[model samples]
Target: MTFDKNSFSLAGKVALITGGARGIGQFYSIALSKYGADIFVVSASQKGWEDTTQKVEANGQKVAFLQQDITNPDAADDIVAAAVAEFGHLDILINNAGVQLRNDVLDFKDEDWRSVIDVNLNGLYYLSHAAAKVMAKQQHGKIINIGSMQSYRAGKRIFPYTASKHAVMGLTKAYADALAPYHIQVNGLAPGYISTEMTKPLQEDPVRGPEIAAHIPSGDWGQPEQLMGPMVFLASEASDYVTGVMLPVDGGYLLR
Candidate 1:
C-alpha cells in the first residue's frame, strides 16, 4: 500500500477546545477548523468569542460555544456532553485554558496558590477525564495539552504557575500511558514566551522584555499562530504514533 500522507487532514473530525475564545486556544480552534474539523469551544466567558465564531464559520465549518467556567468540576462533563451532543463524538481535545499570578514567593497568598493550581492542573484533570471516558469507549481520541516553558525552568515570581505547568506535563504523560491502550494519543505542547495577551505585560517591560529575549536562542518572542502547524499534526493521523511527548514550540529557549 503506497501511503500518501495527505491523509493528515482533520476533515470530519470534531474538536473541543477549552478556553477557545482567546489566546492560544482561539488560534488552535481556528487552525483546526481550517483543517476541516468542526469546533466546539468551551470558554469561561462568551463575551469575546463573537469574532472567533465568525472566523470558524467563515472557514466553512460548524462551531458551538459553551460559556461555563472550567474551574467548576462539573463544567468538564457539561462541556464534553454539549460537544458530543452537537457533533456526535469528540475526536480531539485541547486543554488550553490557564492563568498566571506573579508574586514574591514569601508574599504569595494561599488563595492565589490554590486558584492557580485549581484552574491550570485540576481543571485539566476534570476535562481530560471526562473526554477520556468517551474516547476510551470509542477507542480513539487525541488530547493536546497546552503546557508552558515554565514547565522546565523556575522564575523568581511565578511559583504556582510554574508548579501547575510542571504538573500538566506529568498529567500528560500519565494520561498518555493510561489511554494509549485505547488508542488515545495524549501529548503536551510547551510554548515559550509567546507574544499573546497573557504575555503582553512581560513583553512590554523594558527590563524583563530584554532579559527574556536574550534567553531565547532565536532572540525573539514566538507568535501564537506559529503553533498552528504542530497543533494540526498532533490532532491528525500524522501523529497517530506520537504520545506523551512535550513538544516545545519555543524559539529555541530550552537550548539556552
Candidate 2:
C-alpha cells in the first residue's frame, strides 16, 4: 500500500486557536494557514486581531476572529459553536492561551496562584472538552495543549505556573486516551527557554539570562517560528498515528 505523500497537507481544514491573536498563538494561526488550513482565531482581546487577519489573508486562506476569554467554562460551548458556525467544522484546537505570575513562595498570594491555574489548566480543560465533543461527532480532530519545561521540572517563585503545566501534561495524556477511539488526537507541545515577548524579562536578566543560556546545550533560546513545523505535523494527517506525545522544539535546551 502506498502511504500519503501529502499527509502533511491541511487543505480544506479549519483550526480554532485560543490566544491566536498574538505571540506564539499568532504564529500558530499563521503557520496553519500557511500550510493550507483556514483559521478561526479566538482571543480575550482584539489587540492583535487585525495583524493576524492580514497575515492569514496574505497566505490566501480564510480567517475568522472571535473575542472570547477561554477562562469561562460556560463559554466553552459557545466558543465551539461559533467556530463551527464560522468554518462549518473544527479540525484543530490549539490551547495556547495562558498566564504567568512570579512571586516568592511565601509572597505568592492566593488569588495570584488561582489566576495562573484558572487560565492555564482549567480554561484549557473546558475548551478541550468542548472541542472534543465536536471532534467526537465528526470522528476526527486535533487538540494541542501548550506545556512548558516546568511540566517536568520546578523552579523558584513560579510554583503556580509549574503546577498548571504539570497538570496540563497529565490532562493531555488523559484526553488522548479517552479520545483515541473517537479518532481525536491530543498532544502537548513544551517549549524550553523560548525567546518570546512573554519571556523577555528572563532573556534580559543580567544574571538569570546567562544562567539559562549556559544550561541549554544549544547555547540559545528557541524562537516562535522554530515551533511552526512541529505544530503543522501535530495538526495534520502526518501525525495520525501519533498521540499523547509532547514534542519539544527547545533547540536542545532540555538536554542540559
Candidate 3:
C-alpha cells in the first residue's frame, strides 16, 4: 500500500469548532488552521477569540468568531447557519465545547450534575444534530467529538463528567452508524490529563496531581500540543475510512 501525504492536507476545507477559544481549544483552532482549514469558532464567551483569530490568520486562514452558549436547544441551528453563511459550507465539525465539575458522588448537587450534562452531552447533541443536516445534504463531512479519560474509566470527584463522557462515546458510534452511508464520519478524541488552563486545578492539586502523573506510563501530564496531530488526522482525509472510534492521545495512562 502506498501512503500519500497530500491526503492529510485540509486546504480548501471549512471546519466549525465549538469552544474554539481558550485553553486546549486554542490549540485546536491554531492547529487546524495551520493545516489549511478555514475555521468558524463558536465560543461561549468572546474573551480569547481575538487571540484565536490572530493565530488562525497567521496561518493564512479565514476565521469567524461567534459568542453563544451551545446549551440552548435553538442555538444549534443558528450556530450552524452562521458558520455556513461565513464559510459557505461546513466540511468538518470539532465538537470541542464541554464543561467539567468536581464533587463527591454523594454530594454532587442536582444543578451541578445537570450543568455538566447540559453542555457535555445535550449541547453536543444539539450542534451535531444541526451539523448533520447540513452535511447529509452534501453527503460528506467529519465530526470529531472531544472526550476525556473518564470516558473509559472513572475519575475521583467528577461523577457527572464521567457519566456525560461515557454518553459521548455512545453518541459517536450511533452517529457514525447513522451517517456512514452518507460518507459522514463521526469519531471521538479522548485526552488524558492534559495540562491546560481548564485543567489547572487538577494539575496543580497536591494529591490528585502526582497521583495522575504516576498512572501515566510517560510519567507526566500530557501537553495540549500533543493532541494537535491526532485532531488534524481525523479532520483531514487521512482518516476517511475511520469512524465510530474513540482515539486516546494519553501517555499510556490507561495501561495501568
Candidate number with greatest lDDT: 3
Q: How does model 2 score by TM-score? A: 0.97
Residues 174-224 of candidate 1: C-alpha lDDT, one tens digit per residue: 999999999999999988788987779889999999999999987989988
lDDT of each: 0.91, 0.91, 0.92
Off by over 4 Å in 1: 1-5
Give lDDT tens digits, candidate 2, residues 3-79.
58688889999999989989998899999999899998888889898899899999999999888877775889999
Give each model a TM-score.
0.97, 0.97, 0.97
- Model 2, position 44, has a per-residue lDDT of 88
How does candidate 1 score on lDDT? 0.91
Off by over 4 Å in 2: 1-4
lDDT of 3 by residue, 121-227 (tens): 99999899999999999999999999988899977798889999999999999999999999999999999888877679878899988998899997989899999
Runs of candidate 3 with Cα error greater than 4 angstroms are: 1-3
lDDT of 1 at 142: 99
> What TM-score quantifies how close candidate 1 is to the native fold?
0.97
